[model samples]
Target chain A: MAHDTTIQTAGHDEHHHESPVVFGFWVYLMTDCIIFGTLFATFAVLRNQFNGGPNGHQLFEIGGLALETALLLISSITYGFGMIAAHKNEINKVIVWLGITFLLGLGFVGLEVKEFIGLIHEGAGPDRSAFLSAFFTLVSTHGLHVSFGLLWILTLMVQLAGTKTIPERMMSKLTCLSLFWHFLDIVWICVFTYVYLASMI
Target chain B: MSEHNTTSSGESHGSVSSYIIGFVLAVILTVLSFAIVVTHSLSPSATILTLSLLAIIQVVVHLHYFLHMGGHSEHRWNNICFVFTIGFVSIVIIGTLFVMNNAAVQMMSR
Candidate 1:
C-alpha cells in the first residue's frame, strides 16, 4: 500500500516529481509533438500545391485568426492560474480559473469551427485542393486537441467539485492537462505564423 | 534530496510574475508576427524569418514560464526530454520539406 500510494498518489511539483506518471505524461506529450511536427511538414509541402484552386492567400482571414490566437494564448495563462491554485490546494479558485479557461477554450473552438464551416461554404473545403486539405487537416487536428482538452477540463472540474480534499490524483491530472493545453498553444503559434501568416506573405 | 525539499516547500509552484511575464511576452510575439504580415513591412523571406524566429521564442517562453520548465535540478530529465523532442521535431520537419520539395521540383520540371 505504501508503494502504491507513492506510485499512484497525485503530485503537485509536477515536473519535479519522481513518479513515472509525470515522466510518462511528458513522453506522451513529446510523441504528440512529433505528430504535429509531421503535420506541419505535410502542410509545408502542400502549401503551394493549390492545384488551380484558391491558395491560402485568397482563403485565410487574418482577423478571425488573430482573435483565435488571442483567445488561446489568454487561456494558456488562465490555465496556469488554475495550476497554481491547484498547487496551493485552493479548490474553489482552481475551479474558477479552470472554468474561465474552459470558456476561453470554447470560444476559441467556436471561432475555429466557424472558420472551417465558413471555408467549406465558400467552396474552399478540404477536398477542394491539396492546399486546402493540408490546411484543414493541420488546423483541425489542433482544434481537435483543444476540444479534447476542454472535455478533460470539464471532467476534472466535476471530480474536484465532489472531493473534499484536493487529492494528489486530481493535481496530477491537472498538471498533465495543463501541460497539454500549453503545448497546443505552442503549436498554434506555429500554425498561425507558418500556416496563416506565412501563407499570406 | 534538495530538489524534493525545495518543491515540498512550495517554491516550485512558479511565481505569478513568471506567468505574467510569459503571457505578456507571448502576446507581444504573436502580435508582432501578425503585424509583420498584415503590414507587409518586410520582404517575403524576411517576414517568414521573423515569424519563425518569434514563434520559436514564444514556444520557449511557454516552456519556461507557463510550464515551469526552469532549469531545476529535479527536472533535469524532463529538460532533456524536451530538448530531444525539439531535436526530433526539427529533423522531421526539415527532412520532410527537403525531400518533398526536391522531388516536387523535379516532377514539376519534367
Candidate 2:
C-alpha cells in the first residue's frame, strides 16, 4: 500500500519534517486555550462569591497541590524524552518513557480525585457556592483533560508495543500527544498560580 | 498533510538539554510562586503581580522549549494563529472581568 511506503520513508529518513497534521492539531489546541480562558474568567468573577462558605485559603492544601505540580511537571519532561527516543528510532525506549509518563499522569489524576472527594465530603462541593462552583468547574476540567491524556498514553503504548517500527502516522500522533501533554502542564502552571497560590495570598 | 510534507520542512523537535532547561525553569517558577505566598514576603498586590509575571514567563518558556514554537519563518503561521487567538482570549477574559466586576460593584453598593 502507499501508506506502507510512506511509513517506511518516514521511519528510515533522518530529519523528517512534521506533516500538516501537526499544525492542524495546534489549531485545536488554540481553541482549547479559549475554552480554558473563558473558564478562568468565570472563576475570577466568582472567586469572591463564597456565599457564606469557606474560601480557597481555608480549603486548599498547598502541599498536595505542590505534589500534583511535581508529578505533572516531571511527566511533561519524561514525555519529551519519549519524543526524543522516538526520533532516534528507539521504539523500546520510547515505550518505556511513555509508560513512565502514563504512571505520573495517573498519579496526578489520582490526587485530584482524592482532593475532589475530600472536598465534597467536607461540603465544599461545586454546589456549595458560586466560588466552589467556579473552582470545581475550572480545576476539574483540567483534571479531565489529564485523565484523557493518560488514556491516550495508554492507547499509544499498546500500539507501540505491537509495532517494531514507528510508522509515519504513528509518529505524528505521538507528536500531537506530546504537545497536548506539555500543554496541560502549561495550563497547570496557571492553575497553580492563579487558582491556588493567588487564592492563598 | 501530505501537501505540507512536500511544501515545508518540519520544525525543530527539541533536545534533551532544552527539555531539562524548561523543566528546571518551570520548577523554579512554581516554587517561587508558592514561596511568595507561603512566606508572605510581599504585600498582597505585589504577590499577585509577581505570581502573574512568573506564570507568564513560565508559559513562554514552555512554548519555546517544549512546544518548539519560535519567532522563525518556519513557525510563521503557527505564531500568527497563536497571537490571534491570544488576542481574542484576552478580550474574553479581561472584558468579562471588567464588566462583571463593575456590575457587582454597582449591585453591591445598593
Candidate 3:
C-alpha cells in the first residue's frame, strides 16, 4: 500500500513538473503562423491587380489604420497585465485586466468592421477586383482571429469566476490564451506594414 | 496574498516593468513608421525598407517582452519552432512573390 502511494505521488509530481500542455499550445500557434504567412503571400501577389479600380493608395487610410494599431497594441499590453495577475493568483485583478483587454479588442474589431463597410460602400468590395478580394481576405481574417480571441476571453472569465484560487490547469489555459493574443498583435504588425504602409509607398 | 506571492518568484512570467518597456518601444516604432510615410522623408525604396525594418524590430519586441520567448531555457522548443516556421514562411512569401512577379513581367512583355 505504501509503495502504491509513492508511485502515485511520483506520477503527480511528473505531471505538474513538465508543461507539455503549454508547449503543445505553442506548437499550435506556430501552425497558425504558417497559415497567416500563406495569406500574406496571396495578398502580395494580388495586391496590384486592381482591375482598373482604386488602388491601395486610394483605398487605405493611414489615419484609421494608425488608430487600429494603437487599439490592438494597447490591448496586447493589457492582456499581459492580466497574465501577470493570473500568475499571482489574483483572480479579481486578472478579470479586471482581461475585461479591459476585451473592450480594447472589441474596439479593434468594431473599427475593422466599420472600415470594411466603408470600403464596400465605396465600391471597393471584394468582388470588384482581385486586389480587393485579397485585401479583404487578409485583413478580415486577422479581424476574425481577434473576434475569436474576444470570445475566448469571455469563456476564460466565466471559468475564472467559478474559482477563488486559480488552479494549475487554469493557469496553463490562460498562458495559452496570452500567447494567442500576443501572436495576433505580432501578425498585425506585419499586416499594417505590408498591407497598408507598403501600399502607400 | 502571501500564499500567491510565494509561487510568483519561481515563475518565468515577466514583471510589469518589462511590459511597459515593450509597450513604449512598440509605440515609438509605430509612430516612426507613420511619420516616415507621412513626411515622405525617404525615397520610395528607402521608405519601404525602413518601414519593414521597424516592423521586424517590433515583432522581436513582442516575442521577447509580450510572448516571453526570450532566450530562456524553457522557451527552447518554442524558439526552435518559431525560427523553423519563420524559415518556411519566408520561403513561401518570397518565392511566391518572385515567381508571380517574374511571370507577370514575362507575360506583359509578350
Candidate 4:
C-alpha cells in the first residue's frame, strides 16, 4: 500500500511537471482567434457601408494580395523547416531557417506597408470609406500579429545565443513562438480569402 | 532529453517527399488563384466565390503539410478546440453582420 501511494504520487508529479508551454500557447491562440474573430465580424458588418466612397471592388488589388499570400505561405514553410532543424538539434540550421522565415515575413510587411501608403496617397485611407476602415482593421490586425511574431523570434534568437537546445526554458519559448508563428499564418489565410477575394467582387 | 527524442522521432513519421509535394501544391494553388483573378474569367460574385474557395483550400494545404495539425494524440483535442473556436467566431461574425446590415438598411430607408 505504501509503494502504491508512492507510485501514484510520482505519476501526479510527472503530469504536473509536464511542459506548460504548449498548453499556454494553445490558450494564447484561442484568445488571438477571438480578437481576429471580432475584427472579422466588424468587417462583415461594415464591408458594404462604404458611405459614398470606394468599396472593395474599387480599392483591392488582387495581384498584390496574391504576392502577400505567397510571402506568408513561404514563410510558414520556412518556419516548418526551422522546427525540423530544432528537432534534429541542428542549431545552425534552425537559425538559418528562422532567418529565412524572418526575411520573408519582413517582405510581407514591406509590401503591405507600401500598399497602405499608396492607398493613403490616393485618398483611399481608412478614414475615407467604411469599407476601407474595415479592410484596414482586418488586414492590419493580422499584420500586427506578424510584427509581434517577428519581435518574439528576435528575442528567442538572442536568448538562444548561448542556451542549449533542450533546455526547458528555451524549449518553452520555442514552442510558444511556434504556435504564434503558425497562428499568424492561419489568420492570414482567412484575411486573404474574405477580405481580398471577397473585396475583389 | 526524452522530449527531444520524441520530437526527433516525430520528424521521421513524415517523409521529406511529402513536404516537397505539399509545397508544390501550395505554389500551384496560389498561381491558379492569381490567374483566375487576372483573367477576369468570372463575374464579380463568381470570382469572389471561386477565389475564396481556392484560398480555403490553400489554407488546408498549409495546415496539413506545414503545421502537421491533425493526428491522433492529446494534441488532437487541441486541434478540435481550435476548430470549434474558429467556428464560433465565424458564426458571430456572419450573424452580427447580417443583423447590423439589416438595421442599417432600415435606418437609411426611414
Candidate 5:
C-alpha cells in the first residue's frame, strides 16, 4: 500500500509538469497560424492584381511543384517517426530520422529557390507584377520557417547528445519544434494545392 | 478518461502504421491534384475552389497523424483557441478580398 501511494504521487507530479509544456506549445502554434493567416489574406487580395503581367496560369509549372510538395510532405512523416523513436528512448534512431527530415526540408527549399531563379530568368520576378509579389511573400514565408526549423533541430540534436530520453527540458523543446514542423507541412499543402495546382488550371 | 496521467516515458507509444497511412494519402492527394491541373478540365475559379478543398484535407491529415492533435487533455481550451483562429483568418481573407476586388473593379470602370 505504501508503494502504491508513492507511485500515484509520482504520476500526479509528472502530470503537473507535462501540462504546461503541452499548453505552451499550443500557444506557439496559434501564433504561427496567425502569421500564415496574414500571408493567405495577402495572397487572396493580390492574386488577380497582376498589373498586366503574367498570371498564375501562365507561370506555374505543376511538375516541379509536385516534387517540392513530395519532399515537404514526406519530411513531416519522417519527423513523426522521429518523435516515435524519441518516445521509445532510441536516441540514435531519433537522430537519424531528424537528420533525414532536415535534409528533405533543405531539398524542398533548394527546389523552391531554383524555381524562383527560373522565373527571374523568364522575366517574371516579383517586381514584374503584384501577383508575383504575393507569390514570393507567401512561399518565401514558409521557406523561412523551414529554414528556422532546420536550425532548431540541429541545436536540439546537440542538446540531446548528453540528455536522457524523455528528459523534461528536451521534451518541451521537441514538443514545440514538432508543432512548428508539422505546421509548415500544413502550410505547404495549402501552397501546393492553391498556388501551384489551381494556377495551372 | 482516467484521472492519472500515464506518462509513457521511454516506452514506445503511438502507431507507426498511422504515420505511413497518412504519408501515402498525402502523396495520393498531391498526385490527384496535379493531375487535375495538368488536364485543365476545370475552369480557373472551379479549379481554385476544388484545390483549396484538397489542401484543407491534406492539412487535416497532417494534423491528426503527424501532430496527434484532438484528444482529451487538460488543455481543451487550446484546441478551441486554434479553431477560433482559423475561423477568424478565413473571414479576414475572404471578406477583405471580396470587398477590395469589388472596389477595384468599380474604380477601374470609372
Candidate 6:
C-alpha cells in the first residue's frame, strides 16, 4: 500500500527512500511509549507506599541490575550491527550479530525472571505492598517486551536463513524491530536511574 | 540508528563508528549515574535531579544517534511522531502525578 506521496518523493530522491509502513510503526511505538509513561508515573506515586513492607532500598540489588542493564544496552547496539548487516545484504554477518543480540536479550530476561522469583520467594511478592505491586508490574512489563523481542529476532533469523537473500518485507520488519529494540533501551535507561538508582541513593 | 547513515539501491547502512560512539556514550552515562548514586557525593535532592537530568540527556542522545530521530531524507513522519509522542507523554505523566498526588492527600487527611 504505497501512498502516492511516498512514491513521488521516493522517486525524486533517487536514494534514502523510506516506506510508509515505518510511519505506521512510529505511531505504534508512540502508543507503546504512552503505556510505559503511565506505568512509570504509577511507580513513582507508589514507590514510597511500602505499607510496612520492604522497600526498594531493601529489595533492589544495584549490582545485579547494573549488569542486567549493561546486557540490554549492549544488545541494542548489537541489533544495530545486525541492521547494518541487513542493509548490506550480508546474510552471515547479519545472522552472527543477531545471534549475539538474541543471547544478550535472553540473558536480560533470565536475570529479570530470576530476580522476580527471588523477590517472591523472600515474601516480597507483588501482593506484599503497593510499592511491590507497582515495582513488579513496571519491571515485568519491560521483561515481557524483551521476551517478545527475542521471538521477533528468532523469526527474522529463520526467515533470512531460509530465503538466502534479504527481502523488502523482511527488511521493513527488521527496521521496525531495530527501532523497537533501541526504544526499549531508552526506557531501560529511565528505569535504571529513576527506579533503581533513585531508590538506592 | 547510526551517526553516518546512507541508503542507496534501496538499502540502509550505518557506520561502525556511529554505533561505537553511541555505545560508548550510553555506557559512560550509565556508569556515571551508578557512581553518583553509590557514592552519595551530593545532597539527596541534588542527586535525584542530577540523575534525572542525565537520564533525559541520554534519552536525547539515543534518539539522535541510535534512533536517527532527526530530519532524514523522506522521513518527515519521524519528526512529527517524535513531537506528538513528547506532547502526549508529558500530558500522561504530569496528569497522573497531579491527580494521584491530590487524591492521596485528600484521602489520607480525611
Write out fnat for all predictions, comma-separated.
0.71, 0.72, 0.73, 0.42, 0.69, 0.70
Q: Write the per-residue lDDT of candidate 5 for residues B1-110, one digit (tens) a residue.
A: 12122352321123466677778888887777887778878887887777878777878877776776656454467678888988988787788878887998989942
Report the C-alpha lDDT of model 2 over A96-171, residue by residue, as the tens digit: 9999999999999999999999999999999999999999999999999999999999999999996888888998
> Listing every candidate in turn, what is its Cα RMSD in Å to the true structure after a full C-alpha superposition?
5.7, 5.7, 7.0, 7.6, 5.4, 5.4
* Residue A28, candidate 1: alpha-carbon lDDT: 95
Worst 10 residues of 5 chain A by lDDT: A1-10
TM-score of 6: 0.91
Candidate 4's displacement at residue B91, Å, is 2.1
Docking class of 4: acceptable
Q: Write the per-residue lDDT of candidate 1 for residues B1-110, one digit (tens) a residue.
A: 12111354233545456677788899888889989999999999998889889988998888778777766666778889888989999999999989887887889942
* TM-score values for chain B across all models: 0.83, 0.85, 0.85, 0.78, 0.76, 0.84
Q: Model 3 segments beyond 4 Å from truth? A: A1-18, B1-11
DockQ of each: 0.49, 0.48, 0.43, 0.27, 0.47, 0.49
Question: Each prediction's TM-score against the native?
Answer: 0.90, 0.92, 0.90, 0.84, 0.87, 0.91
Residue pairs with colliding backbones in model 4 are none
Q: What is the lDDT of residue A49 in candidate 5?
A: 77
Best model number under lDDT:
2
Residue-level lDDT tens digits of model 6 in B15-96:
5667778889988988989999889999999999999988998998888778876655456767787788889888888898
TM-score for the B chain of model 3: 0.85
Residues B1-110 of candidate 4 have per-residue lDDT tens digits of 01111131232112244456667888898787777767789997888778878888887886666656655364656777778887888788888977887887889942
Name the regions of candidate 1 deviating beyond 4 angstroms. Answer: A1-18, B1-11, B108-110
Candidate 1 is graded, for docking, as acceptable
B1-110: candidate 3 lDDT, tens digit per residue: 01111121223555677788889999999999999999999999999899999999999988878887765565678889989999999999999999988998889932
